[model samples]
Target: MTGSSHFPVRGIIEGFYGLFYTAPERNDLISFIADHGFNLYIYGPKNDRQHRARWREPYPDFIMKQFAETVAHSMNRGIEFCYSIGSGVSINYASEEDFRLITSKYQAFYDIGVRHFMIMLDDIAAEFHHEEEQLMFNSYAGAHVYTANRLFHWLKSLDKSCKLSLCPTDYHGRAPFSDYIHELGKGLDQEIDIFYTGPEICSETISEQDTADFAAAVQRKPVIWDNYPVNDLAMKSEMHIGPITGRESSLPRVCKGFIVNTMSQAEASKIALLTFAEYFKNPDCYEPWPSWEKALKTIAGEESYESIKLFAENSLYSCLGYPEAALLDLLANKALFSLRSGEAASVSKDVQKLFDYLDSLDEAGYHLKYRMSNYALRNNLVPWIEIMESLAWAGRRAIAVLRALENNEDITAPLNWLKESVSEIRRHPKRYTGSILLPLIEYVESKVD
Candidate 1:
């Protein structure tokens, strides 16, 4: 199978911690996913109390109605709607009452046309909390296996084709497999899919060998819960705007399928998600740069594509790595080195071009800040934009300082302006990933000092 058939399940999972999307946003996302060759949309926002903290309670009528409408909309677009409940937060594996509650909760979603269900045991305690549960089951994984098997059997009874995905408590780690995972793998029904986040929760890369090893250990092909383009958890400070790389082409063959966990900023996430769609469709032939360029053009549209691309280059630094900003950093280094080596005449044209690029980035920052229609993108990207704008200002000042040195003029004011620009860039709250400007700024500051 290739294209849509190759990856039986390729889509986005609304599995972030903070700020769940509004109903309209989710509906738009469903349409977006369907158009981009994605087939699944898992509704598993961590903050939804009824889905997690209050697992036994029914959603209020308004929320339930929204879910029904969303399900209908997803169906209209040829997408599978997977309703995920985080019942493991407080679920009692040994209690018949808890089992009934779980069934009833899923029944409600099944009534709303959700044929796919996910029970998320991630981020919950690994041990059996209740004394009764400890007595009933030998281990925590044993308890989860019991609940998941019961739920899977019930869902199968309702519809034999219904799919179930389980997110285990021990989802990510290297070596020394936890007893919980071993028991869950040994005990889980073959029909139930298991979710794994590779070797780490927010892994930088997921190799095919790692996935294959995990499959061997787990006795089933794990469904990759890819945490790329997701900016929650420890990555809350950075926005991941780069293309999806580091995943081997053979990943789809080893794992069940890949589902990207998107950022809170839906519009911005499309830049990476579209590339992910291309990768899922044909990882063997996928090229990150071309896919990323296409994604940028698609997200920003022709009118604003160039401008957004300039801004996106600076924001492309993520946990994955910073390939997009590599050329810019190289140019900055060359410009600075040329000035320092008294090769000003030879590097003049290159310096001019670099300055022009910086000016364009400043203008792009202005456009993204004031004129962009996507409020989520604008709001979520404010920190990076601030940094980019400052970098542009600093770059321009560096050029001015170089020109002044070439002309044998006093460079005090321009140097001060450069320092101030660097300071402004440093003032932003989030600066871990996208700091391409840091090296250039530090080099220039060293010269000034």
Candidate 2:
């Protein structure tokens, strides 16, 4: 909790595009973040029409009640609940009526004790859509800064405690950014924080120098809107249960805050968020694997650790960059190397180790399917777990076929089973142990002729 060491804002934003979390889920996450020493939570899911598409409108009474409860619960847990609105999708920045509508929307939340807000102009066209906006402002950034600055002043007038953040259209890339962003940096209120998503929207690596360069361009320290472990849109097939990686420990020096964009599965997202909690706690000494193992133990619990670890290792590939199924890759490579060397003793030992790992992968899926106490996590992982089992089965069958050939035995049964397992794996789009599994199967198939 010391100011000198940790990020000013360390939290998760339930800001994915499709199928936002339910009220209960958000409440649970708020409590979870508080326990992990995180200090902020932003609500800005794109699918919530009232929060995005219908930004000018107030939330219905029932939904407003849920938001009130969520805000109250967050405050109770010592977490700041930042209500975010995606207004750029259809905002008429020049219209006084539109400005009033946007402020009125925040006024409702303010009444419910919300003092933190974000005006999101992301994922929208940079060009002005309205005639009035085009005539009033020279560029996209000009219109956005005009609205944001006005909002900041009005919010300050209502309450000096009000905190506002603005997400610029050109929110990512190496600096100096687009003219829009440079203009945003110069024109936007300095008191208001700007959101920047590293070198790319879904950046693989966020270096210290890159962040410093961006801060220089923005004319203020930017709050990192880190997009990781968020499997939505085109990435619907992924299950990102891996650790946080590629972010420099020196990031806190250049950035104002750090916030993760989470996946649709609330419980599963906690696995990655827990690692994020560790990183933000003491970024200087954070090690991805150790932090990841600790996160698995803390969130998944001891009973399901091995199973969840195996599952997580296979599901690690995302935009954040990780070697998928690292353990399996190691063992498979060792076995393949031994096989190539024609060392019978080494081959027997290494190949058996690989086979054992594959066996465990299959067993882990089966055990988690029926035995995992966390039903929500289990449900979220079902698709990937099934694929894990399929890949394991395929690996085992491939090994069996290879062994049978070595012994001069008929490969019919094992070969047929291998084909069946591969077929099962390919039927679904879910990925686990992705690149390694297919090449191993192809290598075994190469042995057949």
Candidate achieving the largest lDDT? 2
- Each model's lDDT comes to 0.83, 0.87
Residues 1-449 of candidate 1 have per-residue lDDT tens digits of: 45665677797999999888999989999999999899899999898899888888999999999999999999999999999999888887889999898889889989989999999999986877788997898778778888899889899999997888899998987655787787888899988898888888888889888888778767999989999999987777777888998899888778878889999888888889999988888888999988998988888777667777887776666668656476677776666666556667325666776788889888998988888776667786777788778878987887777667768889999998987887876776675225655665666566556
Q: What local lDDT does model 2 show for residue 197?
A: 87
Compose the digit string of candidate 2's lDDT tens values, residues 1-449.
45336688787888898999989999998999898878999999999998999888788999999999999999999999999999889888889998898899999999999999999999998787789887888888888888999999999999999999988888899966787777888998899998888888889999888888888887999989999988889888888888889999889889987889999999998988888887887887788889889888777778999999888877888887777778889988888777767744225898899899989988999978999888888888898888888888998898899888888889999999999998998897887777786666787888897
Roughly what TM-score does model 1 have, to 2 decimal places?
0.90
Q: In candidate 2, residue 198 scores what lDDT?
A: 88
TM-score of each: 0.90, 0.94
lDDT measured at residue 187 in model 1 versus the true structure, 0 to 100: 93
Alpha-carbon runs more than 4 Å astray in model 2:
1-5, 337-347, 404-413, 447-449
Worst 10 residues of 2 by lDDT: 338-347
Which predicted model would earn the best TM-score?
2
